[model samples]
Target chain A: MDFFKRQLPTLLVLVLGLGMIIQYYIPTTFSQQVLKNVNLWIQIIAAFTLCIGITSLLRTHYTKIRLQHSGWAYSIILYIVFIAMVILGFYRGIQEGTPFRWLFDYVQTPLSSTTFSLTAFFICSAAYRAFRARTMEATIMLIAAIIVMIGRIPFGDMLSAYLPSFIPGFNDMAGWIFNTPGMAARRAILLGISLGGIATSLRIILGIERSYQGKD
Target chain B: MGIIQKVLNVDRRVIYLIVFLAVAIPIIFPLNLPVTLTEEVMGVYNEIENLPEGSPILIAVDYEPSSSPELNPMTRAILKHCFKKNLRVVTTTIWPTDGSGGSIADKLVEEEARIAGKIRGKDFVNLGFKTGSYAVVIGMGEDFKKTFPKDFNGNVLDKLEILNGTHSNGNSESSLPNAAFSQDARAKKINSLKDFSYMVCIHDDSSVFTWITYGYERYGIKIGTGCTAVMAPGNYPSLQAKQITGIIGGLKGASEYEKLMNYRGEGARGMDSQSVIHVFIIILIFLGNLTYFILERKKTVRG
Candidate 1:
């Protein structure tokens, strides 16, 4: 009984996985129905998962505030803003000309912009400190990155102007790097990732891994 | 400290300012660079082109404002194609926070539909933000009406003319009342994934891959994805294996798609900035490497 109980979830996952895989080749009416039902179930489960993630985030912050932890003050602020956003979003729609819209327009959008904009800062700092040209590979990568950057910006043209007129098509060269070499590198990474993803997913379905059960 | 050390330890704020300028100046004064269309992008285009005009296609927007720069343009381009093809579009978003992102797509299609004199409830419908994630997407494949239950305005499903054969499926010849749309539509159209002709997912998240596996593997419906540039490369193998028909990565993909559709929208404009910015990043990487090489050589000599 214990073994069955432990293995039940994995077994069900496998059966569903196999069923889904089989449904692809056979173009029968019944197979289509099964696929639809499976998709619906996935959507339902995913929706529930979203709530769980958001709730946990709230719980962690709120608990910190309650306990008055060393950084509890920041937690309190986070919780307040989070809860306020939720209330405004759910209770009052952020329709045009509404107070919720104001909150969304002024607070949410700006804050989001600010957050993403900080990526530029972090990228530069990391580049300065971590992007060492210690090896041939590193040196090549650094050169590619810099050429691509200059080729992109107005400064590239300005810098090129100072160079002897013989170095033609500096901007075009940068575009070529992105469109060709950069694309090739990115594609290679994607191919590796996809293979890894397929392997990982298959492993989970075949019961080769049970870490999701928290006993790993 | 030392003179060289002080030079290397330039103010962190200065770095931020430089990066800000790199990303900002391009936005302010866009470039008119040429954009080359890759086979990957063309693959996505060809897949949509081959589908029958009136085929029902599910368009899922699975991202939010945070990823708008990359995703929004892709979504718009897909919407343009679906609408132009006179394809029956079922637009839905997995995340509620991405309602605005969906709105961006919605507004574009609506404007186009209006210009072309197409009615909403009849020709196309915005299913809006559904609460479920992968479940909702899966459920949609099974039974769109059951999963959505209502349109964005909360109108009851049975009443909607779009589902119940109230409107003819684009081609006047297929005007047969959609008896398939009744509650039985779920049971009939979806059992496994083969019921739909194609599914277009514009997302930045990973879980959407389940749709490719579960939907494509089971149903035989071709899957195409549009994702942020960062997420694009990861889908390459899937494309290579032909599990996914095609992918549009980042703003550039969106721009190419937009041009293909003959609809020059935000995507086309965004490309000018994207191209310039990409070149800027390449230069920064080069400078950093050059500085490192020089400094390393000096250190080695001293040693």
Candidate 2:
């Protein structure tokens, strides 16, 4: 059982991972065909992951409902909405002007938009409360933040235009800040992240990283 | 606490109310603010503008409904531009999609195509959603036909004029000389991702990186991106690195594109609300700092 569960998956990863890596260099017809087949398999596997997610959601919600846990009422709502969406999707199809499409356009979109819009309020509140200039570094950051926040808006550009043509406006200054020093820091951080990613991938490919499989 | 401190100490609910007012009032009574054009946004505009008429370009709708408000305008403007330029657009999505499918790529492209007085299969096509995010990109890089055998509307790819060349399937129409000739030079057949004139990916997430790494770097396809405002900063590295041709970032970017197109759309309309909210936030931050400094000075004198 251990061998079937652990050894086999590890072996498959080692072989397939090595094959995928080598495939990039080969550039032959056979390698192309292999890459195509592998990509299809990956897609099929990805689709099944969605199924697994649905199944997990069902199990968790079913348990909560069965136990009559706190907030179990919300679970009922989830089930109703989930089943309704599924039935509508399968019945009339997801094409234009169907009940499914109508529900999507009217119901889902507004709900999502409203939820995301709430962030603006929270952000405003947070900026008012937490954006204090205590230290020198904090002061510098606060100033930069002010420039970027103001510059991103059309009103900022309008205000900037009143200044002399020779002097750069908040727009130009913000662009420089974002593109120059900001990009430099981002590039360094991203390079470190990518290198770390490659290392983790190598560890997994070599079967040296089994943490993802969970504890025995 | 004095007036400044009292104002600073106002309930969080007041802050929320103010933000709501700031956003809602502008939408009702638009500021009609002038949106400034930037070099960053012009990059996307110039690329599509310069493409030969009937040249095929790929559009990836890789955002969800949460980002729809910001990204939808960019998508619409870009689509309008592509159709106006008579460029052949092939759209696909890898964003799993909220089962609540509002404003999806296929539907948006269909709407834009109809308005442009262009035929669907000939002028553009939506290949629809596929699984395996980046792997789907690699698959397309290898061969579009194999990755997407049929369009979103259940139309086989080989039947589409923009996809399969006019002379394909050995039709006797080739014998008529001019009958085989069309505006699209390579419209004969689009085999791989590299065949498209350019690819514009409207994304709210990290999917653009895969396309840039695989589609652009590996296959030499030119890429541009339109993303939500929150995502704009992350995409700057790609824009600076020239991995992408250019970017349309958030509603502001969309409004800039709208100005360039000489058309006022949702993007331009939404800028008023965006500008109001930004300025309001800036004022809040400033007031908060002023209160803090005043309180500190008083405490210092008392000590």
| TM-score evaluated only on chain B, model 2 | 0.90
User: Best candidate per TM-score, number?
Assistant: 2
Worst lDDT 10-window in candidate 2 chain A: A93-102
DockQ of 1: 0.29
In candidate 2, which residue pairs clash?
B165-B188
The list of candidate 1 runs beyond 4 A from truth reads A1-51, A89-107, A136-216, B1-7, B49-53, B95-118, B164-197, B262-264
Interface RMSD of each: 4.6, 1.5
Candidate 2 per-residue lDDT, tens place, B138-175, comes to 88888789888888767899778978754221333333
Instruction: Report per-candidate DockQ.
Output: 0.29, 0.74
For model 1, how does the per-residue alpha-carbon lDDT over B1-303 read when each residue is reduced to its tens digit?
655455567687877676677667766776554455667788888877766555666777777666776677777778777666656566667666764424534544566667656677776666677665556555655665677777664567656665554444445344234323322332233222355567887887774576776567645678898988767756766776788888888777887788788765666677666555455455555565556567778899999
